[model samples]
Each structure stands twice: as structure tokens, then as C-alpha cells.
Target: MEGKNIIYLNDIDGKTRAFTIKVKVVRLWKRSNPKKAGETWAIDMVLMDEKGTKMQATVWSNDFKKHEKILQQNECYTVFKPRFDKNNQKFKHFDTKYVLTFNLETTIRKCNNFIGPTHGFEFSTFKSIKNGGVSSEFRTDFIGYVEEWFAREDTTTRYGKQSYKMDLILRDLEGIALKLTLWEEYCDQMQEYISKNKEEEHIVLIVQFGSVHDYKGTINVANAYYITKLFINERNEEIVNFKRSYIGKASVTTSTHRSIGQSGVTSNEDEFLHNTTFSTIRQIREIAQVMHVIVVGTVMAVDKDSEWYYLGCESCNCKASPSLQFPEDDNGSDDVDPKEVLVCTNKKCKRDVVPAVHMYKVSIQVEDCTGIVNLTLFDRDTVKLWGLSAKQLVDKYLQVSDDEKTIPAEFNAFINKKYAFKIHVKKYNVDNKVDGFSINKLVDDPAIIAKLEKKFDVVPFEEFDSMILPTTVSSSQSDAGVKDSKSYAVDDSTPLPKNYESRKSPCDLKRTLEDSNDLDNSYSVSSTKSRKIETKEDIKAQMKDKLLIPKLEK
Candidate 1:
């Protein structure tokens, strides 16, 4: 092989020929086989050449000691007398067509004259990953700043082994966010770094050989064992330039900055609606590039044609469909029994079906006096508005007979009722039309509800008690002071109508009581109407006088 020319990965064939190549070991791992009890372990590696081509190589247990110590990661080496074989696509993670297997005749030596980069990576944008069609055959690279992260947790794997997982929210300069999941050793390393750098507000992360996973309608980036490499706040040229492009600049600030509750935003609607402008459905469409707007409309229709919830894989939360069932075997024999399973369509997770979770994705048409528009409510906001979790809604809807083919009565209560919705809008097309709208917050404040009732001629359930009290009083007993009394008395103490049970769910009742308690505890000797208009200073003073506020002891 002295005079043989070096070949790239694309030129590899099964023909026996003498060849010499220089490459670096980018990744290394071990696989075990139960059949060979005495010698079960085999070393596997991913190698990359100067031309940025990669290939998979394996060293069986018989030849492990011969080359295990000689091969070092990120170091160039020259190898000869290697044999090539057809790659098993199911087990291959590299982009090469063939894989290398080491035999007793193979020779490995350190390279002294070669000058090239240790590793080469092809970076992908968040846009492409989010648009779907990311092949699982090969891995990709990603770089972004860590916006937020969750605490490390221990989870039980399908094999009954305990594994640790950490989830990180990453955002790029284009204002796109993606979830990155690290497992086992990677999770430990990240958690260690986070503990050490507790004072740092932002951290830049670089992920190599990370795979894309689709969960429901969202895209996530995950790490593969042994093949994935992570660099956190490293001082490399590429990292330094990426940091400079975003740090200490207004444009970068806007792109990287996010609100405290941006992920879920489950706080009271009053906080979000404080400074927002209220608009009708028609006016909402006329505005351009408005981030948040409030709208009051009657739910004209609930979309029953579309599914209220979807089955998602428990591990990755990707949408899954029922697997095909075969009643008989291929030979037309009835020995095989038919069974149902949920199959994940996402190529990244093609395992045997597992237990699935319910995810909400509901669309409803809302109409105001001016115009009508269709709005969508995702998981969090849907739970808030419907007063039920996705799982609860699925259970309730499935209880009905299949032939009826209608939504639950709880959903029908939403129709012809008024609500103050806080929506986030995105404009699309040349005409600047509002193409995307999602319910961000659900308002139930009496002040806001009263204002909407007066302006839009719509009444909420909470205000119905006040609106009908005056009409129910007898004219003979009416007095000047009767209008000032906030209490209503009935001759009999019978229970309310049964229709009220269908009008509100258990969660709605709990929320109403919580709101009432919040108002009572925050005010002193002030009526509901008076407390609504009180300024921040007045409320603070009232709280200080009536309640003992705790102070931080620093």
C-alpha cells in the first residue's frame, strides 16, 4: 500500500484493493452481545477524513487490545489493510455507504506530516429543523444561546433502568426557539456547569451530531449516545464571533430577550391585560405587527369535525397513529392474533408502540358585532379556557356513543357565550392580514368583564347574577336603599337549577372562588366596584395596614 492513492468515503467499494488513508476518530463507543458471554464487548468508532467525509468502524473483542490504546480522539492517524463491508442502515449513524471492520492484518500508526482540522460539522438552521422532513439517517450540528433550562430528573427507561434527563431551551438570532434534550452523562455534565456558573445570565451552547426529534407539532433537538459532543461557552473563534454578533447590541437584545413567563404564562390575565389595547375582530385584522391584543367575541361555533386531542408518544411526545392490525399470518393461517398499538410516525422514534399521552389542539370560530375570525387554542390556554385538561376532555368525549358524533355538552356551553380573550397575532402575506392567532390569556376580571359587557353588549357568567337581580325584585318592595344593598334574599333556600352544572366545570368553580378570595384578601373595607379602580399606591397601603407583609432577611 506504499504507492496507493488515498480515497474518500464516496469512493469506497467492496473490491479488495490496497489503500492508505489518514483520518481522526471523532466518536467512540462500545456494544455488547449476550451470545458471546466470555467476550461480549466490541469497540465502535466514527472517523472523519480531511475532506469532511465520515464513516463507521468497528473493532471486535478479539482485536480490541491491538488498536484500543493506539487510537486517540481528535488525533490524526494513518491506517492500512482495513476491510470494507456493506453498512447496516439500521445501525449506521454516519453518512457513508460502507463501514470499516478491523481484522488481524490491519495496521494503525500516528500521522506526523498531516495538517488538517480534527473535526468537521455541517450546521443546520432552526427553520429547516422546524419545517420537518429532517432525515434520521444522519446527525446535524446546532449552535444557540441557552434561554432557560429545567432541573435534572431521574426517569425509568423501557428496559427498567434509571436514566437522568435534562431539557434546555435554546434560541438563535432569528428568534427561533428549540428544545434540546441531554441524557445520562450529558445531563450530568450540563448540570455541573450550570451549578458552577450560577451568576451568568446567558450561556452559549454548541451541539454536534445532535438528532432532530418531532414531538406533536413541535421540533426538538436531542443527543445520540457517544456520537454527540457539547461545547458550553468555549473560547473558540466561531464561538467568539457568534457571541460578538449578539452581545451589547439592540437587535441582539430583542432577539435573545424573553419574558419571565414566556414558556407557559399561566399568571392571572389581569397582569397581561393591564397595558394591552382592546380591539374587535375586524380591528384586530387591520392592525399590523401588533404583538398582543385583547378581543371580546361570542363563540359562534365549536369545531367538532376536527379532533380535540391527539395521541402522543410518552417518551418524545410526538404524534402517533394506531398501527395496522393483521388478523392472519402471511400464509393465510389464523395462528397470529390481532393486536392494536400506537406507532410514532416520527422516524427518530420507530420503536414498538408504547403508552401515549393526550395533547390538546382545538380551533373555534369567534364572532363580534363587526366580523368573525377563527382562533386556535393550544395546550395551556385551552386548559385555562375550557376548565379541563386534555386528558379529561378526551375521556369525556370518548364516553359518548360513536354514532352521535358530537362534542360534549360541556363544550356546547361555550357557544353563544361572551368572553374576553387575550390573543397573540402574527401577520402573513403581502396584504398584512392576520394569519396566525392564538389565545394567550383568558380574562375573568369583573372590571374588564363589565367594560366589555357595556361596549360589546356581551355578558359573562359572573355578571349574570348582578344583571338579573334587579329584574327579579318585586316593584312593591323596591325602595331607594334597596338598590345600594349588594345582597339578594329569596323566600325559599332551594338549590340552583341543574343547568348550572352543565354551564360550569369543577375547575371553573375553583377559579371563581380563588378570584373572590384574592380580591377579599387584597382589599380592606372596599366594595368590588371600588377596589377595581383603586391605584397601585392605595392597594399597597391597604395591604400594609391590614396584613403583615413578610420581609426578606439578607
Candidate 2:
């Protein structure tokens, strides 16, 4: 391995281009284009030099086929005349400032006598990860052993599509535990391994290039889309040494139970939920990221004037909207129901037309000592609250009355009721200045409510009358780094904003329903430029129809 002609990864600079270098393909993955179906975006990889320095590199979709068969993970090759580009992506796997790109003239040849470490990993400590000392912008590697694992779950993603996920409690050698989530194929791999090794203890897991997330002030790791590599109980040198040194020692114990969502809550998640104090409605509004918090509030009133349910796609549960293209009755059949043939608002849905299912979207005004805010209950939470699915309620009300707006008498169960609501506040709500929060989990059990009330020093329900909604949000709230507030309303007869077509999250549907009329609120979207800003008086004037959630100082 000799020569002054060979370039190393660290030798690249701003002016470097079309250079020859010898590096090992430590990792390789095919990047998919989310916008285009079945289309690859690029061929991405991590390349390590002879000195153990690594750099990010890619082959564009146009040139991917040229080197698809030649490039292999853990194989060293001499890459010739590859162009250099700045590594400025939002999520990066390495610390290199520049990434190599294969161009028309780029060539490669296998290096037979390559000498260097086959793998390069710089793992962060569990303490540093929990303390927020590591940079979350770049992906990092971490290794731990599975102390406890949850059963695989089939859950809906943010877009309302069904997906598989698995949760595990991983403990490092230092006795610190961390939560890890595996999505889709990763779950299948883990399940396969578990099925083969029934009695095996101390399952080691190494998450390579995993994404770090801070949820509710606790750090967790999840496998990234395609570039993440998962090594489960592999007989690598580090894993062998880790198991040999700590196999027979005393291990930490954790008791897990199935939570409301049929998912097991890890020890850390349980601590954050039960041990932490409740968050007031005022504090919930100040949150600018995705978080879960418990809030105790009395349901002042329900908006029975609006329709309480929307039709969702049967395939994915996304809100369905009327499409210009109706079902074709080739045989002149009478079986096609116009209500059933609707377009799924979720872009991920593959079908052009899908049958619809009734999903609840009940908005209620909730009041606590802090302030009054609107909370919308989706299908699952509403079903738990009323003990009836949206379809069953709709059928019951249709039998007794002809008016669709008249809610079932059973809906009165929510009025004047005090309950602990686990609200999931998303950044979409904060960014769009939407006041209505979505309830993911609702606890009405008297025992749990009483415990929470005693823990938070609760004020009696009679005293909530003194806590009135604020008429105007303080201008200082904007100066405190919160984004500028804007109000948007959609006119169903008009076309929606172009970007709105891609907005498929549950929060987006809730925001639209809050701003628009009941008849066509399911998939409505309005542009900021077309809507006029409402003043304080205008906001206060609409309080009778839409109760304004005030952003007040804590």
C-alpha cells in the first residue's frame, strides 16, 4: 500500500475535486425518493480511509446502476476521480464537511491488499446522550444489551397509516437504561432472531447511525430510514468482550405493562408520566415541539352544532374527501354508494379510491385553573370516552333523528365532567397558531384522577369559574421566540393551497375542522396570503363560536 499519489478522506478541502482515493465501503444503503414511488433517490454510503477516517459519499440515481454491483460493504476499493460536494444535509451520519460524489468519469477498482480497520464507529456515552451533550443533528452509534423487550405492535403512524413498531429497554454496562424503537423491517429482523433463540439472555444490540430524539425531556434512539444498521447479538469483538465481562453479573430489573395504546411503556416513559406533575393548559400552549402531558380539565361544553364525525379512508384511516372522479358503474350497478367512493387525503395511500369509515372528531371546550382551551378527541380516545365507535353512534343517531348535526344523547356524558387528559401537542399546532390540542389518552378513572389531583394540589371544579379565557394574547409572547401568529380559514368552495395536499397528519385535520364549517372541514386548507389577520376584538368576537385559548404567562 504505497504511494504519494493516493488521497485520504481528511486531505479533502474546498478546492479538492476529481481526486483519487482508496477507502473501504463501511456501509451502503439505497436511498428512496419519498415523492416518487419505487424510485431510488441515491446510493449512499460511508467510506473509511486507511487511517480510519470516514467520509460520507453518494452515487446519484442516474449513475447508481454503473457501480451497483461493484460497491460492497466492508470492501476496500480505489475510487478514481470522484467529485467533492459540501455535506450540508439536515441529518448526517458522519462529521465530514464534504461528501464524495460519483460523476461520469468516476471509476473504481478493488484493492486486493487493503490494510486498515474494517469498521469505524465513534459511539457516544449513555450519560452524554441523556444529558444532551451529543449533537442530535448528526447520527451516532450506541451499543447496549436488551434488559426488557416489548411485544411487537401494529400502530398508526403520524399520517394514520398502519405500521409495525417494537420497543426495547437497553441497558449499557454502566447500568443506565435507554429506550429504543425499531420500525417496520427492523422489527421483523428482531422478531426472527427472538423466534430462533428462545432462551437466550443478554441480547446485545448495536444501533449504528441511529437518530436521537428528545421526547418529553427524555432521550430515546430510533433506527433511521435505510442507512441505520442494527447488529443483534452478533459475535463481533466488542460484543463478545462486553458479554464475557458482564454476562453473569446482577442485571437491572424492570416491570412493564401494556398501556392504553396497547404498547408497553418503558420505565423511563412511566416515570415521565406518573411521577411528573400535571401541565396546565397555559403551559401546554407554550410547548413548541412534540410532547405528551397530562392535563386535568372540566368539559365546559361540546359543539353539538357541528357534525361530530368525518369519513376516513378504510385502508389507512386518513380523512377522506369527495373526489371529482366518481366510481365507474360499468354494468350500471346500483351498489356503489357515493359516500363510499372517496379519495384518501393521505398521499401514502396507493389506491385512487378507497372506502370510508366513520371516525370521531369531537371538539370540546376544557377549562382548568390556568385557562380554557379546546381539545379534540379522535377515534380511539372518543371511543374510550363514549364506549361506542363512531359508526355505531352515527347509526344510533340516524335511527332516532333525520338531522345529521344532532349528536347522540350519550355525548352529554362529557359535559361538566372532570378528567385527566393526556394531550399530544405537535409542532404543527404551535406553528399554525392552532389552539385546539388532540387528546391521545384520556383517563376518567376516579382513582387515577384523585391521585393526580392530590399530587398537583388541584383546585375544586367550583373554582374553575374564576379562570376565564383570555381575550387577547400578549404581544410579548411573540418576542419570546415563538413564531409569529397567523390565522387561516378555508372556504370549501375554493381551491386549497398547494402545500396543503401533503398535510396528512391528524393535527392538520383537527386544525382545519376548528377553522371551517362542519360540512366540508375534513380536508380544507387555506393559504396565509389569502387570509386577513384578525385583531383582538375579532378574536374575542368569535369566542361564542370558537373559544380562543389564551397564551398566558406561567
Candidate 3:
């Protein structure tokens, strides 16, 4: 009964029930061999019996002359055989045990039996089960923070209008879970629910059915399907424990399942990834002007000279303990350490790989949108546009210590300094939490590489402008003890050289100067302030430097 070749068996719900179902027939159609749609008998309708049991009422020469009343609209009869509609894409079934027919084979009976609701498969309990495949339709209460939301498009047609869709990550008491696709009108409603409450606060919902289809070994839900109801039912600490039938025990069939829903609305994207509103490279540059954008992908090649930072393990945040510089290479031997290192921050690489170079190079990764593509920092141009370092720009988004410098244990465990460092992280992010998730205008234009590069004077890595300078020197040489002195038309109290002025002050000027000197050494004025002097050497040297040029090679 549990395997195959079985009838009158207990259903998946564990209900021990069987019935000799009955049916009353008012109308029937004889399935025929008349070719329709280039096929013989494209599955015509069926008439079932009063016991809900099936028997073929074949349309033959005998039936054409029999049971004329069953074809009448107001007339009724007891009939046999049932036909279920089949979608072309879905597998079609012809009930072999109860073949469909036309004319009645039995008497019409008036029995009292009606269809009942709440009929579906049962699911296994999530607890007390380590792992197994899950299949069922159920109802249960569940809660999860809004990790992410995907809204779908809708359209209209001759069969009235269509609807939208929603995909979300739903976590519960059992554990983190996978994709829940919402169909029809529920899609739009879920969209509104998501936009309003995108934070990590718990949200409760009831799931009717899901995990019906496995896409790429990952459960995926599509439109034209099942239903799930998500609502904020009663808030206690804004959390409620309810039940959903769709939620059930999921078992690990294998490790390559590529877990879904774990990367929900708030789930950190791949380490070192920065998803931007911009999709094109042009757009990437526009945002790079003010904010540094970094997306994480696989390492095609590490920078040749990239400094390797040591970590304890690839999968642990426990940084390796270290002393200082490497011990001097004694006895003409090379220096090496046994420490494990990471070129990237992925804490899960199975093997150690080094960065290809010191300068930022493109990393490749497989993404749903762009497969096996490079993720870059928009550096080629934005480095010149925005002078802000990616590190400093990221600092503004950091949630600073407001608890009187008491560092949270999670952060303290990974950090060794009191201040921000150029430490790489598992996620590249915009300070969306800052200012209502909208970065300031300074960070809006992502293509500001040209603007950023202007702030730093670009010199070769080894060249230093402020460190040293060389210049041509002549008469006024500091190294030769030359000092600039006040210039005068003539030396004081001495006969002037030929062509030098030796003129004495006029009698009136002399009298005024004598009176001014007699009154005070300073009348809020210094004697040097009034002195103005120029020399032939100063003008000739200035002109020569501006105009002189060496002769070109002949």
C-alpha cells in the first residue's frame, strides 16, 4: 500500500478513509476519435458515478441511440468515469482504473455527499529531525527579519489583468530557510509590507505551501502557483509564534545545495561585494567620485607585491597571534614563517592564495545577474576624481562607539587598534543606515575618480616632493654667507663711488628730520618701514633668468 499497485490506501495525511463515491450526471460528452488539433481524441470529458467511482461511458454506435435525457440541460442521471483537466506543460493523466465515457451504465441515485475543504498532503515536523528531503502542504506560524525582498512585474491580458510576485528569506525557530515565492495579488501586498519594514525586526506570517520546485538544487517558487499570507499578527516585542503548514522539516540531501534565503535582505553579500544602484560601468564611475565602491569576486590573479596579512584560519575570525618583525636572516639563510595568511578576507577558502599585486586588480566571481564577471573599484578614473580614500569614506558609515568607548566584543575580537584602519571586510557597503539609508550628496556621484585623484599630488611611489628640493643659486647664496642688506644711493658718512648719489637733503627737509628725531625714536613707526631700495644686480639677475637660453645643437 505504501509503495505502488495499491488502492483504498491511507492518504499522505495518515487518514484511514475510503469511499464508494457517487455522482449525478446532468450533462455528458462522448469522447470521439474525431481528430482535433491534429490529434485523435484530445481527451474529451467524462461523467462520474454517484459513488465518485469511475467507469467508462464510451461513445459508440450504441450510445448515440441511448440516454438522450443525460444530454439535456435540466435532466439528470447516475453516471460513471471522471475527467480532470490537464495543462499542456504539466503531465496529463488518464485514470486507467476509471476510464471516462458518455452514456449511463447504472441507475441515477440521489445520495448525500459533498466536497470538503482542507484536503492536502502533510509535512514532517521540523524538530527532532537531523536532515531529509521535505514535501508537504501545511499551515504554521513563523517569524524572520526582512533579510531581502524581490518584487516581480505584472501585466494584463484578455483573461482580465495579471499580478505581481515576491521572493523573500524567511527564518524561524527551526533555522534559517530558503526562497518563498508569492504569486498573484499577494505579490504587490508583500511588496508594500517589505518597503515599510525592511529592518531586522521580527515579522510573522503563515505559509500555505512552498519548496515545490528545485531550481539549480535550490528551492524556487514561480508565479501561477501556491499562496502564502504574511502579516504582522500581534506585536510582543513585536514577535509572535504561530504555525504554517508550508514550513516544514528540511533535510540536507547534500552540501552542494547552495543555500538560499540565507542571503536575505540583510544577509551580508559575498565578502568584499558592493552592489550599487548603478548597473553599467559608466554609472559605476559616476558613483566613484565621492564614495569608493568595492565589489568582491574571485581572485583571477593576486597583485604581485600585495602585502599578505596573516590570519589564524580561513574560516575563523580569530586573527593569528604574532610578535613583531621577522628575525634577521642569520647564517645566510632565507627567512620564512609558518603562519597561515589570507590575500582576501573570505574566511572560507580551502587553500591559501596570494594577492597578485599591491594596486587594486579586478576580481572575478559568478553572480546571478552577471555570471563569471569582474568586480572592480572603478579606480582607473575615480582615483583622479575623488581624493577621499575608500577607508576614510567608509569610516563615516561606521557605527561609532557611543557606549563610552567600551568596544563591543564582536568588534574588539577582530580589531587590534582603537582607531579605524584600512582593514578589509567581508562586505563593501554604502552607509545606507546613515541618514535613512540615503547617503549624502557627497557620496551620490559614483564616478568621481577624476575628482578624487585631484586631492593627492600623484608622484611616483618613490618620488617625494616635500622631502627634498634642489635649486640654482648665484650671488645670494646662503651656503656662501651671502646676506641681503639695505640698498642705498651712497654709503653713510663716506664719499659715494663714481655715478653713486651723494646729494645732501634740502635745508627744509633737514630741519623737519632733525625735529622729528628730537621728539622720539618712534612715533608708532619703525625706521625700516620707510626704507625702499633697489640694485642693478637684482634687476639684471631676474631678467637673465627669465630670458637666457642655451644655444641649440648645430
**Predicted structure with the largest lDDT when compared to the true one:** 2
Pick the winner on lDDT between candidates 1 and 3. 1
Candidate 3 Cα misplacement greater than 4 A, ranges: 1-89, 92-121, 124-132, 135-150, 153-164, 184-186, 189-211, 221-554
lDDT of 3 by residue, 455-523 (tens): 222121111112221324454342332112111121123332332223221111122222222222111
Candidate 2: Cα lDDT at 24 = 85
**How does each model score on TM-score?**
0.45, 0.45, 0.23
> How many residue pairs clash per model?
0, 0, 65
Candidate 1 TM-score, C-alpha based: 0.45
How many times do residue backbones clash in model 1? 0
Query: Candidate 2 — which residues are off by over 4 angstroms?
Result: 1-4, 248-554
Clashing pairs in 1: none
lDDT for 39 in candidate 1 is: 58
